[model samples]
Target: MPGQLFCFGFGYTAEHLAARLLPLGWKIAGTAREADKRAAMQAQGIDAHPFPLPDPAQALAGVTHILSSVPPRDGHDPVLAAHGGTIAALPDLVWAGYLSTTGVYGDAGGAWVDEDSPLNPSSPSGKARVAAEAEWQALDLHLHIFRLSGIYGPGRSAIDQLRAGTAKRIARPGQLFNRIHVEDIAAALAASMAHPNPGAIYNLADDEPASSSDVVSHASTLLGVAPPPEIPLEQANLSAMGRAFYAESKRIRNDRIKRDLGLTLAYPTYREGLAACLSGAVSN
Candidate 1:
């Protein structure tokens, strides 16, 4: 059957997925944060609506697949608060996806974590995602929870940071993180749709995990620019939010996506992903 997708938050990751699915006989509809963006998406032939949707039932009219990139706000899921019942009642809805975060696993001391890892979030944002995942799972829908690591792609990668002179190389020893390109995220989501396994939780991350400073240095080398001088972790003046990222260190395992859904990451590491971003293969 031809698919109809309704994305609750048609932001960066969801947009990439829509780009892939639109040409394959998929009808896309979603909620955008701004009026101008909603108009723009409509011009692109999407059934886009304003967010905090006053009439979610209307927006959900013929949606067979639903994807939510909406993060929880103030300890509650906005989507579940507004239209959880409507979604539960939709008889023909085939799939629902929630974009979660690996932060829910808390600090693993640079150890690896998989889908079955325990939930122990260290930050408020991470805690909120954990709660949101549970709320979505409780709906008893054909739900797929994707726990993403650090997300970077296209205009959002380190190449953009280097060009803008905003890239930093904080030298925190043994601090490692896994990241997934947005395109890879879309591919994994698409694969899951083709092989729907309800109640599946997959980690959407690259095969290799590395320190932030190393990745920044690589981007600088690729751009032929002088890399930012490294500042020791203790000497770096970081905001609370930025420092929170340093408090956690985990190498996320992505074997489940490959094993279960047969998905392979187009960019298995930050090097390949940043290269693609610099080459104009992806747009902002």
Candidate 2:
């Protein structure tokens, strides 16, 4: 079915998601926070609107599906809060997807975490996300949670960081990291959109989980340059928020997405994603 979809906090992920969904003959609407971005969205020829959650207008009226790309800020998501009951009341809305992070599973010490893993978020952001998910799930609406890994895509890849001299090689002692290209996440989102499963939870991570240093090092290698010097976790200059992310580690599994969605990852690991992007294999 060609569903009418609305994407809240439609930023990077939603942008790519809209590209895929639009082609599949779905009616798509997205949100941009900034007025400048709204104008930019118009220039890009995408129907990106501007709105906040927790008190959404009639937008959810007939929305058959919705994807929330916005993360919880300060324990409140206006969009989700405002429309929780309203959305639940809408019989047409089949699936409501929340793009959460595996950080909710907390620092598993590189242990594997599936959908059944108990949430033990170590960071404020992750805790807020978990709270937000709970709020949505309590709505008695069709809900799905997609726990995303580190996101990378064209123009947002590690090469951009390298060129800008902002790349980090944070050595946090065997801190395993997972990633997924924007396109792959977008494809996975589409698969879920087409095949909506109520209350589904899927981990959207790359097949290969490498250490932080390994990923940056590999990206530098693909670009034919020495990697940025490693900065020990203690010595690294990071904001409280950024540092919080380094405090936890988990090797997320994507078996549920693959098995349920019948999908295969294009970039199973950072090597493939970076190699292809650095080599200009991905089009802008």
Candidate 3:
């Protein structure tokens, strides 16, 4: 479709998504929290500006697509309180997406969860995300929610963790987690935008949901190094907030996105994805 798109809190995911969508003939605009980053975005051919966190009442004129990659706040997002109306009032906007977390489906004990699964978030951040998703869903707009899992890609993967000597296999029993390569996320998003599916919830995750230890062990094996010593979940010395995540166990399902958006993920599992990251493979 021929339209202008806006991405709020345009971080890593949005950056990669924008790079893909631009060449496909979509006009783009995005927010920057820093002045230097704004300049850098403009230099890289993005229409860069500061979009007030709680977006202002002023309309964005003709933006047809909007994606919010802003991580949910620790408790509540005041941005939603202030700018929800502004977002809801956009007349020309056709598709709006809220990036959330699968942690909202708290402690399923590795049972599978699809789009219609109940939300019982354990962490403060996850609870906040559930609330945010509610706000957008109630807006009567074309809304799609992406409950993302562990996000890893080029410079942000097991390789980085292993090389830095910070890769530890935390012995959290049944703490299965899902992940998606950055390229697959970008691809899934582009598919959604191109073929708008409002009021849809997509679990943006890979096919496999492996335990934390499994990932660490596989990553170490791939690197031809010994796995890091296992740290018991209780004695792991995690921050109070980090410990909250360790408290839950769940596995995400991405079948909805596959059936709806026709997404065949480039990296279907952490094993393939992490291997690609280590071997310098790119998504086609």
Candidate 4:
């Protein structure tokens, strides 16, 4: 049955999910921080509203499913802090989802991490996610947690970076990063909604984990442009956030999503994902 979904943060991944569900006779509504973004979502038939809604109970009166993609601020999840009680009290709520990051596993030294892996986030942002996940789990809702890898699709892929002259080939030995196309993320979320399992944590990632430089080179090849010069990570002029991203080297294992949700990723690897992005095969 199609049910109304309320996403706490209707950003990139959430928008893709909404696109998939809308065609199936599902009603989509969510919160957007910006007025322009809210207007845009409202124009697309979403019951858009600002964050920290003044009356969340009224806004989410008939919502059956909820998804929170909002990251934590200062070690706290804003959504849960503001509206967790109202969400927990929703009489018709069936399923809830929290979009987390694989960084919760921290640096596994390029080792593969599964859902059973311990949380050992290294960065401050990652630590905040860990805290937020804990808070969400404590709530009295049928919640599923998704620890996503690097997200890229459509205008957010390396193709855009290369075209904009921001693509970099940073060489770091023994460093591999897992990534999932945004479309695949949406598919996985939909699959989970179909097979609602409370208290389940799944990793959303692709089959292959490769170096950042390799992805950039492949994107350049697809664009028929010269690849950026390979530079050592130590010498690369990366911001603190970029440096933090490179600090972790672990491959995420996504067996649970397939085994439990019965999902088969359309773009199994970066090759197919990038090709789809280049050909405009996604809904974005």
Candidate 5:
């Protein structure tokens, strides 16, 4: 099952997944938008190529699995537009995964949302994801959709934000956000690769959906620093993107991944996840 895995956007999540699969004898190759990033990946032994792959067929010659973490561009998926035909023609392609956002289920009013929940996206990015998902589902391939929650791990966690003095405790009463560790996301993806279930939609989130202030405060406690003062959402002086994120809140459900893929998250909540980040205990 570990033949060749090609990732469309080999960024943070894809890098973590590669860390797991590479050790299992899988040949890893992917595209990065920046030449420097491509060079870094190639230096780390990945067969990295630039985005908008110059020769799609030649690059994807022996790929058994494909994962696309690329976001939509101008209301359409770039990967499908560029290489959908070639990918559909691959004879030995076994599984294909698309990393989507749980934001598609926008502003559940902090209510729980599962794979069956109806999509009501409020942001342009979320709407683009809905369209991209439809396009992927339309293709004749073994596809699995992973609607990921806020991904946090290692250098991307609240601890790092606090250390960088960018940790904000914006107060939106009753607003909660769901999060998942990158390692857990990699684990779930690996489990799904082992048990390929076509047409499945899984939510990749942790057990707890907590407020942003709570997460920041916990990270502060771990770092032995005073938590930043909480500012009301309206007075937070956030950018449009930040305000847009604060406007919607939802508690994502992850029962399907556990039931279908038999995955148990290593860091089940922000507390354990931030602790691991502080202790530098991240592992594959």
Candidate 6:
């Protein structure tokens, strides 16, 4: 039978996953915060509706898979709060996925952390994710949680930042952050669907972990332009969320995704990822 996938948040990551599954005859439905975005998705043949799920039972009637990319707001997961009962009661549901951030591992002193790492989220958002993860686990379903690293893709990568002249080389010594290409994220999700493991937690991150300044420099080089001047972490002016990103430094281990799911990343490092984005732009 063809799969019916419903996403709680049809943002960048979910869109990539949907694109991959659509070719395989999957029926995709999702929620958008704004009516305009929902209409836009409907225009593209997607059954997207404004969130808070108007008709929970009706909307999730034939949904075999559920993917939640919505972040916790005010210490609550909107999806669970709104339609937890409806989703739990769905007899047709097989796989349930929640998108989490690697920040849940907190500051690891630049050390390697895996699925077994103790979650000690430092920022407010990270703390909320920890809470949401626990909440989702309480539901009796085939739940699979993914702790994603910094997400970057074609329109949302260092290449775009550098080209837009908004890229900043923030120098934070010993700060190694892991990142995952959006395509790789979609690949991993698809792989999990092929081999469903209930209660499994996977870290979705690239093999290489580098500093922000290094990524900026590499992106500038790819664009054939001088990199932005380096700004020391102490002197850099950043919003609360932005500064919180640098507060945690951990190299996430992705061996579980490879070993268990039998999957390999297409862009294993920032170099390949940035280069691909640049080439893709040129070709387009």
What's model 5's TM-score?
A: 0.98
Model 6 root-mean-square deviation? 1.8
lDDT of each: 0.90, 0.82, 0.83, 0.93, 0.93, 0.91
Per-residue CA lDDT of model 3 for 1-284, tens digit only, reads: 56788888778998889889778788887788899998988887787768574335443557888888876565555446647777778888889888888888987877898789999988778888888788778788899888899899988988779999888789887788888899999998889988987888889999888887888899899999999889898778899777988887777889888998999999999888889889998885
Question: Distance (Å) between predicted and true CA of 101, model 6?
Answer: 0.6
What's model 2's lDDT at 12? 87
Better of 3 and 6 by lDDT: 6
lDDT of 5 by residue, 1-284 (tens): 57799999999999999999888889999999898999999987899998788999899998999999999999999999999999999988999999999988888998999999999999888899999999999999999999998999989999999999999999899899899999999999999899999999999999999999999999999999999999999888898867888999889889998899999889999998999999999855
Q: Please give the lDDT score for candidate 2.
A: 0.82
Candidate 1, residues 6-43, lDDT tens digits: the string is 99988998889989898888999999989998998898
TM-score of each: 0.97, 0.93, 0.93, 0.98, 0.98, 0.97
Cα lDDT tens digits for candidate 2, 1-284 = 78888888878888887777677677877788798987887775566676754335565657888888777767977676655556677778887888988888889998888889999988888899889888888888778898999999888888888988999998888678698898888888888877778888889999988887888898898888999998888888899988888887779888988899988898888888988878767532
Looking at model 1, residue 172 earns an lDDT score of 89
lDDT string for model 4 (1-284, tens) is 99999999999999999899898899988998899999999999999989889788789999999999999998999998999889889999999999999999999999999999999999888899999999999999999999999999999999999999988999998899899999999999998898899999999999999999999999999999999999999899898878999999998898988899998989889999999989998733
Candidate 3, which ten residues in sequence have the lowest lDDT sum? 51-60
- Candidate 1 wrongly placed segments (more than 4 Å): 282-284
Could you tell me which residue pairs clash in candidate 4?
A: none
Error of 1 at 254 (Å): 0.6
Sequence-dependent TM-score of model 1:
0.97
Candidate 1 vs candidate 4: which has greater TM-score?
4
The predicted structure with the larger TM-score, 3 or 6, is 6
